[model samples]
Target: MKITSQNKLLLPVFCSAFLLSGCWLDSDDDKAVEPVELATSANVRVVHASPDAPTVDIIIGGTPISQKLDLDYQDATAWYAIAPNTYEISVEANLPGDDANVLTFSPALVGSQTYTILAIGSVGQGTLEALVVENTLTPVTAGNVRAQIVHAAPNAPEVDVYVTAPDTLLSAEQPLATLAYKGFTGQVEVPAGDYQIRITPAGSTTVVFDSGTLALAAGSDLLISATQNVVTGSSPVSLVVATGAGSATILDKDTPAEIRAVHAVADAPAVDIIANNALTLFDGAPFKGATSYIEVAAGDYLIDVAADADNSIVVIDDAAITLTAGMRYTAIANNTLALIDLDLIIDTPRKIATAAQVRIFHASQATPNVDIYVTADGEITDVSPAFSDVPYATGALAETGYVQLPAGDYVVTVTPTGTKTEAIETGVLSLAAGEIYTAFAVDGDMEGAAPQLILLDGFVVPQAN
Candidate 1:
């Protein structure tokens, strides 16, 4: 959606703030082509704050600003340049066929001013909107950093924010401010050093959101926004730090990781899934069925799967598994009975409100290389397969990373490498917006029938008590 420099009038001419150091420019040589006009321009940055929104395409005039990098959830851009005048702009959710226009802006830009344009709220809740905050351009004192804090989480409650030293007790500490949704603080310059940010319910000392130790380097300008937690974790919010260079998210230190396990050992019986050979993660889990995600503290552990609670009849024993904080994972007991193994897959869970993200896995030992097709109503008479020759999962989740599709009814079919004969065909599935689907092609029962598709929410067995 980006246009060339020759077509400036018909397309966008936005310049990155970092390349120009928050100045107005046209090319990427760190200088302005039209220095006279650049003196009266607005320094701007765009923030994608909508937790449930897909990757976006920002249209200014008629060109998209995403030719360089996509603007995804919890992402932001460096300072960019625009003329100090009113212009038409719109934010669109980049879907498969047609993009959905989620928000539009018509802010009048004053010359010699800085601004932040944010796309906020939930796309499914019909609250997707635009927020424009004019920043005061001023110099920071030497040995100090400028901080601007904003409350951007729509459903989060009003809370007291604290930026204090790490491990400081809240009993005697005073919060910097109490901010409701969409409220922001004026730029405050403070001595640059290490600090911790925490948020508590209004007028209470019960800490609900905690950001562990953070370092504020000297002479840095920071836009620290509290946003809805979508990248994992049980906390209601996470802090996004946007500086002149880029942005990063800070999750609560105690955030847990969720894991789901699938029973895909072809010839294995209903098995007892265990962890560390002691704790029972799943008792009598049948073939082709899967366990829902179990939230556990993020760490490393060992897993074992035995028949009927008997460790001696083990199919899998003491498999090493590691989980990270604020992330989701899937572990499948795949391969044939004689060669039973596990396939670990990293799960992506950022649900976009305007589309459905579908992930397909090849876990069947009976089925060879496959050609997968997600077609209209599962039709495959004259269409090409979306994935061709997808091999079996060999100790790792052989998958197609999340594919974005328009929200609607669709059928998923899996066929042998080049043939139209379906090994697995899912009926018309009504995939709604703001959701993620994980489908695995599994081997049939011990009797040996046609392979089938097993849709699971996630994968991985938890460590037992």
Candidate 2:
């Protein structure tokens, strides 16, 4: 009787029976019993594809397979080997005072196969999911390599991918493949060499993403992916390349910064905020009004607030502002025209799962030192100040540290210290879970112009002002 690969399952049972029987065998009989080969182990690699999800730790079978793995946006992990078996995979967000798994999956891996488990979709939008792909790692022709591309960018549209030489102009080149969200391409063979990758809209010449340069070794198998770029404010798509042997690398493309303009000066007229005194960034912003967040390339600009969009009659002149990548900023045309100035505040909001983060900014030069009260709406008279004795100009910009509060409707009031008799700026604000907020007290002399609270939904634009 011959033992083939299909009959290999019975070999374990046959060996167990032979072990139980204490039969004395000759040395020649022992030589006749050949060793049975078992199935090869499987290879698995993890990719963090969630755009806004924080750094995560990958856990397998109740134990952490990757510890403190800082897989930021578009990051991938090297491949790991495991015996062909079922596994309980879990992904936990590396947040303070939290060890809860954000996602979990149970998969049974097969022998001599490769698998990629990806964490995809948005975390706050409740669309997060884990996607598994069975990878093909068969060797290609000599001096050539096999590569595939996976599109995992949840917010991106159908895109064309281009692999070319370094410094190649995208407008003059053709795409290698066109893929939609969650789409995967079959393995394509190419000569092993140095190459660059670019992504553009389908049938368009505009390049949306670029991977400077990468080297592909001969006989290597590669898996490239398009993922969400969280660092960029507009959530542009980025890329991650993984080898068949499990090594992964992220090729980040330049993304725009986020910014919004706020007309906080009560006495100033309606104006247009211009970048570099030429390009109109915010048009026709009225007093106490704020524009929606706009995306721009990360760089320095001379921001000028003009009375009109024609760049004539500048109200706030030549305010130098530097915009950094992956950051959110608010340019406020604050104070009266006599004391007209620009206040640039860097807004970095950290959202908790169950609560909202609130911060206070004192932008009103006329308002005296006051206490800030954040209490349940209609309960301001019964509660004390949340932030007490907050001075109007403490060194640089008067701002309070973030305070986490339960998500609900709350009333914010600005009053003189030790007395809540006359609230200068009082307004009702509704805070939602997993969001951050900033309340700015604006306007000069209560007698000249009534003080009001300009509420900013912190990281984005103002929901209401």
Using TM-score as the measure, which candidate wins? 1
TM-score of 2: 0.61
Model 2 lDDT tens row, 113-222: 77888888888888888988885434456666567888998889998999887778777877898988888887787876667778888888677776555555555556
Worst 10 contiguous positions by lDDT, candidate 1: 1-10
| Model 1 score (lDDT) | 0.73
Using lDDT, give the best candidate's number: 1
Which residue runs of candidate 1 sit more than 4 Å off their true CA positions?
A: 1-41, 66-68, 276-279, 458-465
Tens-digit lDDT track of model 1 for 206-280: 888876666565566778788899756678997766665556666786788777777877688788878777777
Q: Tally clashing residue pairs in candidate 1.
A: 5
**What TM-score against the true fold does each predicted structure earn?**
0.85, 0.61
Residue clash pairs of candidate 2? 79-246
Please give the distance, in angstroms, between residue 193's alpha carbon in candidate 1 and its true position after superposition.
1.7
